[model samples]
Target: MPKRLTLTEAQQQMLDLPAELTNEPIIITKDGQPVMAAMSYEHLTSLLETLEILSDTEFAEKLRESMAQADRGETISWEDAQKQLGQ
Candidate 1:
């Protein structure tokens, strides 16, 4: 779970958190209501990329199909794939 901190407390200790801890979002609250969230750049980028993929209908369908195929063991060896692609 992400850590929760008051706005003032976040300002004081956000930067002091260990690098591993920063991977999770830090929920900042003001007057006991959530006001903002902070996360590492890498985490933000990954979320954005996932959002992009999910928002594209064709790509998302293709991803689901690919995952289902893998689950069904419909996969080729890397060398066979490379050969098919003439790589």
Candidate 2:
């Protein structure tokens, strides 16, 4: 889990961001309430990629349908797939 840092604690811990955000993000809070988060660039890029996929409704629907078909044991074999693709 990420570390929860208070405003003052976040200020004091700012220098530790390099190592702290390496493994997990930091939740920065203010006035005893959750406020924002600070994450590493790599983590942000990964999250952005996930967001991009999830945001594409058509692709997401196709993926969900494929998962449902797999759950029902409805699948195609490699040779059948190749044949279907006219390969």
Candidate 3:
């Protein structure tokens, strides 16, 4: 479960939390309403790397499909394709 902390408490405890616990994210609150989160650099970097890999896989599949269509002479020029797409 996500940890909760008042903004002031979060500030006070910031330096005391372990690296792993720091990365576990804390939901900061203001007047009992959630305001922000405290997350570690390691977690953020891992998330970013995961996103990059997912995007790369999607792009690679798209590139391969485009290449296959080109080989089959089923692909149009960029200008024509743009016009067809109403761009």
Candidate 4:
């Protein structure tokens, strides 16, 4: 988990954002109430991608089915995946 800090502290360390966010997020709180975060672009991008995937019901369903199939010992070769996707 990321470390938590007051918003003021984050402002003081604004110049070190890149290095500070290299490994974990910095959660900024206000009046002791959680408010914001300071994170790396890479982390933000990953979160956005996760949101996109989770928002796609069809894709999520397909992924769930794939997991179930794998658990059932069903498998497919990478060549077959390429063929199916016409790659």
Candidate 5:
């Protein structure tokens, strides 16, 4: 479960909370309404790494399709490509 703290209480406990619950997320609230959250650097990095892996998988699938088209002679040669680019 996420730890809950009022805005004022969060300000008071911010320093200690980081160390006390380094593996969990803390939810901060204003006027009893949820506003923001604080999580450990490790957790944030793990989330970013997962997102990168997912993006790479998508890119790889697209690259495979392009390669298949090229192998089937559906792609232009480098010289032709250069001419098309007016290079």
Candidate 6:
């Protein structure tokens, strides 16, 4: 579960969170209602990238098709791929 903090507590302890805390966001609440989240820049960047991919209609369609193919066992083996690439 993520850490929760009130607005006042967030303001006071935002900078006190450990640097290694990256997996979960800090939930900021006002009057006990969640109003905001704080996460590492790296996590934000990753989320933005995922959103970008999801928003690209053509790419997302292709990705879905690829996943379906994978589910249907249409992929080649790693050795075959290496050989095809002359690696």
Candidate 2, 4-54: lDDT as tens digits: 989899899788777879888899999978899999999999999999998
Q: Write the per-residue lDDT of candidate 4 for residues 1-87, one digit (tens) a residue.
A: 778889888888789778989888888999998899888999999999999998999999999999999999899899999999999
Q: What is the TM-score of each candidate against the true structure?
A: 0.76, 0.76, 0.55, 0.75, 0.59, 0.79
Question: Please, what are the lDDT tens digits per residue for candidate 1 over residues 1-87?
Answer: 778989999878856754645559888899999999878888889999999889999999999999999999999999999999999
The reply for model 6, stretches above 4 Å from the true place, is 18-20, 85-87
What lDDT does the true structure give each of the candidates? 0.86, 0.92, 0.82, 0.90, 0.86, 0.88
Q: What is the lDDT of residue 50 in candidate 6?
A: 100
Residue-pair clashes per candidate: 0, 0, 0, 0, 0, 0
lDDT of 5 by residue, 1-87 (tens): 888999899899978877956778888999999999888888889989877875897787887899899899898889999999999
Tens digit of lDDT per residue, candidate 3, span 1-87? 889899899888877755536548878899999999777878878889877876897787887898898899997789998999999
Better-scoring candidate (lDDT), 1 or 3: 1
Superposed model 1: Cα runs more than 4 Å off:
14-21
As for candidate 3, its clashing pairs are none
Pick by lDDT: 3 or 6, better one: 6
Model 1: lDDT of residue 2: 76
Predicted candidate 6 versus true structure: per-residue lDDT over 1-87, tens digit per residue: 898989998788867765634787888899999999988888889999999999999999999999999999999999999999999
lDDT of 5 at 49: 89
Model 3 spans with C-alpha error above 4 angstroms: 18-23, 57-87
Best by lDDT: 2
C-alpha lDDT of residue 43 in model 3: 80
Kindly provide the TM-score of model 6 when superposed on the true structure, using C-alpha atoms.
Answer: 0.79
Better of 3 and 6 by TM-score: 6
53 Cα displacement, candidate 6 (Å): 2.1
